[model samples]
Each structure stands twice: as C-alpha cells, then as structure tokens.
Target: MTNVKLLLSAHRRFNDLLSALALSADIQPFLAKVIAAVEEFLPDSKVTILILNQETNTLHSGAKNNLPDFYNEAIEGVEIGASIGSCGAAAYLNKTVIVENINSHPNWHSLLPLTQKANLHSCWAVPICNSSNDVIGTFAIYHHQPKTPTAVEHEIVNVAALITSVAIEKRELEEKLRFNASHDELTGLFNRAYLNNVGDSFISLCIRNNLNCSILFLDLNKFKRVNDVFGHKRGDKLLCQIANIIQQQTRSSDIAVRFGGDEFIIIMENSNDLDGEKVARRIHQLILESVSNEILALDFGVSIGVAMLNNKPQSLSQLISRADQAMYIAKRSNLGIYCKP
Candidate 1:
C-alpha cells in the first residue's frame, strides 16, 4: 500500500475503533475488533494483545485472532520483566520492542523452540498505556518470517496501541463508577442504598426457593467517644478495621452493609437464626481482637442482634427492624449478642 493510502486506512480504522468503543460494553470482543483492524493492515501477520494483571504483575492474553491455541496457552500468565519476551519487555519497559529475528534475539532465545513450533519468526510490540501513562498491556504483531517493521508498520503499531489504551481506560472507569455507586466511601462496604436496591429481590428469591434468610444488625458501642477523644480520622480508621473484620466473618453470598455511622447490617442467605447468631458472635469477637490497642482502651465493642425469616415471610425492611430491636436489647442488657423472639 502507498504511504498516503496507508495513512488513510489508519484514519478509517481509528474512526471504526472509536465507534466500536461507544457501542461495546465488553473489553474482549472490542479487542478482537482491534486485532481485526490490524489484520487488515497486515493480513499475513498474527496479532495478539496481552493485558497486565496489576495484582499479579503478569501478562495474560487478552485477545489473539490468528495465533494457535497451544501458542497462546504457552504465553499465558507470562510475568512482566526485562528480556522476558517481546510483549513482556514492552510492558515492563513501557516502550516498543521489535525483535526482527526471534531465533537470534536474546529475549527470544529461551522461547525459540516454542516460537519455531508456532511458526512465529518475528515480533514487534508496543505498550498500551492509560491516560496516566501507566503501561497496561502490549499490542504485538507476529510474522512467519524474520522481518523488521517498515515505517508504515510502525504507524500501524502506534495506532493500535493508542486505540487499545482508550478502550482499557474506558472499561476501568465504568467499573470504578459502578463500584463507588454501590459501596460506602469510608468502610468500603455496601452502602444502605445498595441494600435498598437489592434487598427485596433477594428476599423474593429466598422465598421462592424455600431458603431461610437472616439479618444481623450491629451497632458499635462507645464509637462517638473515639471520635471525640481522638478525631474523626481515627474514628474512620476504626470503622474500616471493623468493616474488614465483618467481611472476614461473612461468606461471599452474604451482603454486608454500612447502614450508617457506627451501624452495620449483614444479610445472610440460607442461614437460620442459630447460624446468624453464630456469625454475629464470631464477628463481635474478631472485631474486639482486631481493634487497635488505643481503640480498645476506649471500651470500643459491638452489640449485635440476629433475626431469621420464619414461615411467615417478611420483607427485608421488617427483618432488619426486628434485628435492630434485638440489637438495642443486647446493648441495654450488655449481652453483646441477642436473637429476636
């Protein structure tokens, strides 16, 4: 293709990718579309995108259109580091890596046998970066014969990397927004709003399935003293610690919420009154154990009330009300935990 024609083609692909971004709700399929665009530019080469998992500091295949399954599997979960491979090095260095001869390049020496088996002789990779300039992934092209990237190929690599970065950033932003909407800012637990939204649905599902749903209401004792004695910042730290303890006691199926200041609620699925009480006591003990020595010195503790769904079905609000009443009784009597009658 002529240089002018290549430039025009890149422009069209860029527009198409933007349109896809607007319509695409998922990352994988959109990445596939990106690979397709790159394939159009170099039909004989195989294209792959490897995404970095921040927690593991490893690269996983995000999309690969023309690569063999075994080849893809071999590179799965490749750690990002210097001289690792084309994609790994590109991601680690936050720059492009071009290995014109896979067999002879030091980076490719260890994987030479695998590359030969896969019929991949050359690789050129560009790091995909987010708005903050953090490298999030690598966009790479592989050829069957050793060949250096031409000027036009370089342009194609740059465009593909830019497009992929935009897509990744967009997806991450959507996820963060969704998380913030449902979670409490202070404790990172579900907020009362999220419980309100999903509560009725959960109750209905339990009723339909003949499952017992339980609610545990927890109120912190002497929390205000902590805020007054230390500061609001100290109080927030204590609350976060308490929240983490509660999360540890509950299973993934349970919905734990920060109902408001110093008050938490847990909705337990398939739990009876006995089971709810057990979890509440466990949480109370753990919270006491996990609190800082300074916070414990202030007599900070938790009072819990356990309520279970009976034969007469009740809404989530009613269940929580019963648990709340029980919690007050526990607080008044120094019981630490009380089950609703």
Candidate 2:
C-alpha cells in the first residue's frame, strides 16, 4: 500500500512539472524546469534539449541540466546521420535510440570527443514530433555510469518529446501564418498591403545608412492583347511565369511584389554592383528569351521603368508616382527598354 501511495504521489508531481514547463512564458525558466523535472522524476542524469534549425538542417542545444556550457557549445552543429550519436541519430531516424554504453557504441564513436569533454557514458534520445508527426527536435538523457534504460525511463522520455514537439509546432505555424499574411497569393511575393505597412521603416533604414536602392516598376507589354488573344487562364500562366523570372533575377534580400494586374514591383536593396539599368536589361532579355524570335517578330516584350533612392523620401506617394510616370514613358517609347526617372 505504501509503495502504491508513493507511486501515485510521483505521478501527480510529474504532471505538475509538465504543466509548469508548458505554461511558462520565460524560455530559460521553462527549460530549467524541464531539466529539473527530468532529473527528479525520471533519473539522476544529464538532460539536454536540442532544437532543429530548419535552414541549416542541423541540431542546436537549447537547454541543459547538469551539463557544462562546453557541452552546449560542442553540440551546436550535430548533423543528422545513421552513425551520429544518440541525439543526432534519434533526429535522423525519427524515433527513440539508445546507446547503453556510449563509449563502446558504434553510433557514438565519432562523438567521443563530445563525450570526453562532457563526461558522458550512457545516452538515450527520442525525436520530438509535432501533431503532424514532423520531427522538430531530439530530447536526450545522459547517465554518468553506463546503464540500460528501463521501460519507465523510456516512457518519461516519450512524454518529454511530446512537450517539445508541441512547442516547436506552435511556433512554426505562427510564423507560417504571418508570412502568408504579408505575401501575395498568386506570386508568393510581398503584396502592396505589406509594402504600404512596412515600406517606410525599410526605406528609412536604407536612407539613414546611406545605402543606394532601386525600385523597378514593371508592366507586361500589351497585356490587354494577351487577354484578348489568349484566354484569361493563359494570361494568368504568363503572370506566374513573369513572377518566376523576377524571383530568379533578384537577390534574396530584394523584395518582389505583384503590384496588381500585369504590374510588378522589385525593391533592389544594397546595390553596389547592381545598377538598376543592368537588372532591368537582364529581365528584359530573359523575358525575350522565354518566348522566341518569332514572338519578337510579333513585337512582344516587357517595359520597365526604374527609380533610385539617393536621398530620403519626402513622401512615398510622390516617389512612387514619379516611378509610375517613368513606366508610362517606357510604354510610350515602345517595348524592350527600361527608363530611369
């Protein structure tokens, strides 16, 4: 009866700890709590939490208990692999993997340097998966003395994985939603709405730093003819193709936008070697390339007008209006050229 009573008390404490970790707003405190709970309820062990960096496809240490800062530093760039240590292996395999004696385990062989630095022996790792079953991180427990995990220990790790998974997924979804809101539906570029809201701050920073930037006002030549000759569906296809071309030509830091209808905007940032005319000419060349000489014989191409920022804007409305005027000038001059305003 006493043994059963003790077990019940432990279960309640475990639930409380999980709840506290989940509810805490402060990241460091929450991580500390998770480590403490794992140490008290699961085993006397070193606990490390790793979070995945999606861009790099690598794992980085997020938090730890009973481990040196060097352990955190050493584990910063663990890659996913079959022969990687328990945590990295779990991340690669998308499941729980245990190295009972890390010193002798084939998987942990290359990671011996990290173990030597951190004084590791037994290691168990489980992949933390989201509600969608995507692995977001790995939760690892290390024992100073070599030991095989019991079923209870495995269960505890699984629970920890579940918590980590939820946290990551929540963050990912929020970011995705924010991105969607800021971007255009058709071209996956920043919308006019996004620009209207955030343009001032970005442009202001460029001006303050004495940075030279260019804005291109692009319009598809005789797009009305395109709609009249081909169906609206074909026109949409052409627009998507144009968007792809714009994305290909511009740097990742540059902002592309489907300004509306057949019009597009490109924000050329930090242009040292990047002349607006060169970018415009390159885009014009590509558009011509995408079609053919036969299409050129038909006199079809894109007209682009560019404006550069040498000084801070008096008003964005006036600045954009001048660029728009330049675009009309390009249109009037005929296809296959860009005008600088």
Candidate 3:
C-alpha cells in the first residue's frame, strides 16, 4: 500500500512539473519545480541534473541539492571519457552508466582526485533524451555511503528522466515554432507577422508617450528581371545579401521586417523626419554600393520611402499607406533613393 501511494505521488509530481513548464516561457521555472518534485518524491536523495554545453564540453547545473560548495565546484564536469566518472563515462559511452563503488570502479579511478573532495560513495546516472531520443542532459542521484539504488529508487530516477526529456522536447518545439512565426525562412529576416504583432506595440507605446516613431517602406528595383534572367536561386541569394546589409545598418532598437515579396519595412524609435529620412537614405545607398554592377548578369537597387511621426499616426495601416505612396513616388524618379512621405 505504501509503494502504491508512492507511485501515485510520483505520477502527480511529474504532472506538476509539466504544468509548470507549460505555463512559463523560460526554462528556469520548470527546473525549480523539478528540483522540488524530486525532493518530495525521493527523500534524503542528493540530486543533480547536469546539462551538456556542446560548445564548451562542460556541464551546467540544471538542479542541485545538499552538496557542499567545494563538491559542487569540484565534480561539476569532466572531459567525456571511460575513466572520467559515471557521468563522463555515461556521456562518453552514450548510455546509462554507473560507478557502484567509487573506490574500486575502473571508470571512477580518474575522477577520484576530484570526487575525493566531495567524497561521493556511489553514483548512478541516466541519460535524458527528447522524443527524438537525442541525449539532452542527464539525471543523477548520489549516495554519501556506498550503495546501489533499489528497484523503486531506479524507477523514480527513470520517472524524472522521462519528465525532463519531455519538457526539453516541448521547449525546443516552442522555440522553433516562435522562430518560424516571426522570421522569414529564406532570407532569415523578421517576417510580416512580427511587424504586425511586435512592431505595432512599439508604435503604440511611442504615440501614448508623445515620442517619435518612423517607418520606412522599401521595394527592390527590377527584382523580377533577376528572378527571370538569372533564375530564382540567384535572385534568392541577392535578397539574402540585401537583407544582411539592412540588418547591419539598422540600430538594435529598430525593428526590420520583410513585409512580403520584394518589400521590407523598418520601425525606428524616437526618429523624426530628419532622422527617419537619413536611415532610409543610408539603406538606399548601402544597396546601391553592395550590388554596384551585375553579379551573375543581374543588376539590383532599391527605392525607399520614409514616414516620420511629428505625432504618431492614428493606426499602423495609416502610416504604412503613406510610406507606400512615397515609395511609389521614389520608384518613379530614381531606382535607388529615399523620398519623404
């Protein structure tokens, strides 16, 4: 009956972790809940979840409990090797691994120098993986004195790994979904949806505060000829190149979004007519310089239109329409220049 209740409690704890993860956009909240759940479910257990830093070959603390500062710092990470420790060996071997008695295990021998400070007796680690089964991190429990986990203890660790694995997978999926929603896949620039959602908020805030707001509408000149002549592949490459230049020229606070096919927009904060016109002109000059002549037998330039707020427009659509009209006028005069709206 006691074991049955423990299983029920473990099930409830896992659901709690998932619920917390779903509510918070950041990973920290989920980690905190996970640590709490582990404490509740596994009494007197020392737990640590170490996540791999692929770039640095180091491990980061996802969670930790009841470990001294010296031990925490000492055994945080080791190079992936068979003799490095249970974790290093598990990661290196790419499987669930253990060092039952740190004193005598071949794998724990090299890690002894570090583990001696913490005096870890027995440790077991299980690789946490996503739905795709790619290793993301590890779930570990350590004993202060030499002992192997009971069947029930190992089951609890397994449950923790399952919960963590699913959380990691869901978070990654959410990030990818967000990226797709807000950015252009081909040119890797902000998308129209992002402009409508986030860009409008900036404009609204500036208007409420009686501050400056500006928007630039730009169109690529003769972009169709390039797509027709050099093929869409080279036309796509040129667009990416142009987008990169625009990103570099725009201030960090400014928002740049690809409005749609062959067109882009920028929302500049605290920019008056003069400031707005200058940014538009700069982007125009940059495009002219970047593709000065035909590359792969194609020529390209851009027409820019600037709309600055002495007072913010009644709506985003109103500002965008004014800029669009200005772009049409600039397109008529010069292929690459900015016109005030």
Least accurate 10 contiguous residues by lDDT in model 1? 269-278
Give a tens-digit lDDT track for model 3, residues 1-341: 48778878888888877887778788766776776777677666577777776666666676655677877777676556655677766655668776678888887776677667777788888887777676677777777777787777678788887888777778779998989998999877899888888876887888888887878998987899888877999888888988898899888888888888899998887544477778787877777777746652454568888877655355787788888888888888874555554
How does candidate 1 score on lDDT?
0.89
Candidate 3 collision pairs: none
Better of 1 and 3 by lDDT: 1
Q: Candidate 2, which segments miss by more than 4 Å at Cα?
A: 1-29, 53-57, 113-117, 185-188, 201-214, 222-255, 267-275, 290-300, 307-314, 338-341
How much is 302 displaced in model 2, in angstroms?
A: 1.7
Q: Quote each prediction's TM-score.
A: 0.94, 0.75, 0.77
Which candidate number has the best TM-score?
Answer: 1
> What is model 2's C-alpha RMSD?
4.6
lDDT of 2 by residue, 213-304 (tens): 77788888777766677678877777888888899999887878888898888777755635777888898888878864543454566888
Local accuracy of candidate 1 as per-residue lDDT tens digits, 1-341: 78779878887978887897888888888888888878888868899988899999899887756898999999999999989989999999999999999989999999988999999999999999999999899999999999898888898889888988899899999998999999998888999999999988988888889998889999999999999999999889889988998888888889999998999999997644478888888898888878888877888778999988888879999999999999999999999999997
Best by lDDT: 1
- Local lDDT at 330 for model 1: 97
Runs of candidate 3 with Cα error greater than 4 angstroms are 1-44, 54-57, 69-84, 103-114, 149-155, 185-188, 198-200, 207-210, 226-237, 270-273, 285-296, 311-314
